[model samples]
Target: MPSNKAELAVRIAAAQPGDSVRGLFFKTVFSLIQQHAGPAALESVRVDALATNYSDLRTYPVQDFLTLMYRAADVLEATVGPENAVFHACGETGVTRYATGPGMLIFGIISRGDPQKLFAGAQMGYSAAVSYGSREYLSTGPKSGTLRVRRDMLPPAYHEGILTGALKVLGLKGTARAHAHDIDRVDYDIEWG
Candidate 1:
């Protein structure tokens, strides 16, 4: 790995408590974008609103953000193969709450799965209520849904390296292209770097 990239990864790994993970992740991704895609590329990239449930209360410095991105990249690389890409924050933006148990934290990735397609699907979904009998219209809906299907195409190898760097920071093990499940969710494309 290049020195600058390695340093960034290491810094992210070294992040302590009270840091901003989301902010750092965004900056890191932007740095990678500037490095590979150039300043012009930044203009093309559009960050969606933080998911409704997402909160900024959680503090993650650069290191924490990098660690999370790295872990996510590891999962993607195992599924998609190495590629010249980077991970961006997707899904609900908020303090990720953990249950009082052992488990892995979940994150989402957004990419140009089918560059050939003209439109990318929305990342979230919801249901509306309809009246039954005596009650007026009331709806029960999901908070979110799968945004896109896994394209099964591998990204370039460098992309995987970025993810690997991030994972090393968190000291977490990642599986290649594992099928993570959510009710009524679509398959997300994953690859290993």
Candidate 2:
């Protein structure tokens, strides 16, 4: 975990070049901060860390989102526990919010209550969400698959939360283990009913 604000800033500055995330994520995280820590905390993160206001119609740099996520995790960690746990829950909520909202119709039609389709459809979802990285879901068996992501901007735990959240929202029992090959790469081994 980042030991202090400066460390966090350095981490954000280290984000990959030319990477950006959709504005919906900004709105989602702002809502998360407001829900967990209140308006003041949200405002602080927005102005101090993000250096901008939330806008659902524009894309923001990956570093800005990282700052928001890390700062939000720091604020909510006291109430939510460890940093990983906070990020995990945030990931879960992020995906849940998106999957149930703007992404609803498309994901619903693509997934059709099937995990395989959901996994395959995730690539499209990823494309719609971020301007960097690539996600590929390869089936290993009838009930298992590997979700490989390259140049991922988020932490491994966050992606783990994403996989689990996706399964949960689909009402499937499952497990997802994240394999972080490097800061920019991760592979998820997933099994579901």
Candidate 3:
């Protein structure tokens, strides 16, 4: 829906209050910006979002996180073009880093390399990372499923990208198609081989 940073900023400013995200998310987004758009771009985003001192153990308002996300998207678009793909790539990097992190290593081992298992645990992961919203995973068959997310404020491409990244980390090739019902709700139909 929002094709540019200005529109995204307006939407984020009006988002419902009370939700907060783990500061680790800010770091991931900053890393992505620094890698693709350079440190200056990253610094610009941090200043714009007023997120210069984000810490992994703290929580920050979701609005601030959305501002960072929207700003990061703009920088990525400027540097990479093909806006949606860049946002998706940003989401992938976020998930890939988290999945490979020390905290999530046990979940991966417990999943026994099954993407479905990893997907089914998405709600737990999401809960740990944010203070609001919900994620539900539904299995359609042996290699297909749907992920329904509610009340999440992230861009749809980012959510779909998480699904793509999740499958990749589990060594499966998959596709995730986002069906957004609004900014607040989306369902991602996913299949893997």
Candidate 1 local lDDT, 1-193, one digit each (tens): 2123453454444344443433423444444444554555544442332211222233334343443444334333433333223342211111111100111111223212221110121111010000110111111222111123222111212223322332332333321222323211123322222
Q: Judge candidate 2 at residue 90 and give its lDDT.
A: 75
Candidate 3 lDDT over residue span 40-159, tens digit each: 888787774565688876788888877777777677876655657766876787788777663385356756788778778778888777788889999999999999999886877887
Where's the lowest-lDDT run of ten residues in candidate 2? 1-10
Tell me the lDDT of candidate 1.
0.28
User: What TM-score do all the candidates reach, one by one?
Assistant: 0.26, 0.88, 0.88
* lDDT per model vs. reference: 0.28, 0.79, 0.78
Better TM-score candidate (1, 3): 3
Cα displacement (angstroms), candidate 1, residue 44, comes to: 2.9
What's the lDDT for candidate 2? 0.79
Which parts of model 1 are misplaced by more than 4 Å?
Answer: 1-21, 46-85, 88-163, 166-175, 183-193
Q: lDDT of model 3 at residue 76?
A: 80
Between candidates 1 and 3, the one scoring higher on lDDT is 3
Cα error, residue 105 of model 1, in Å, equals 18
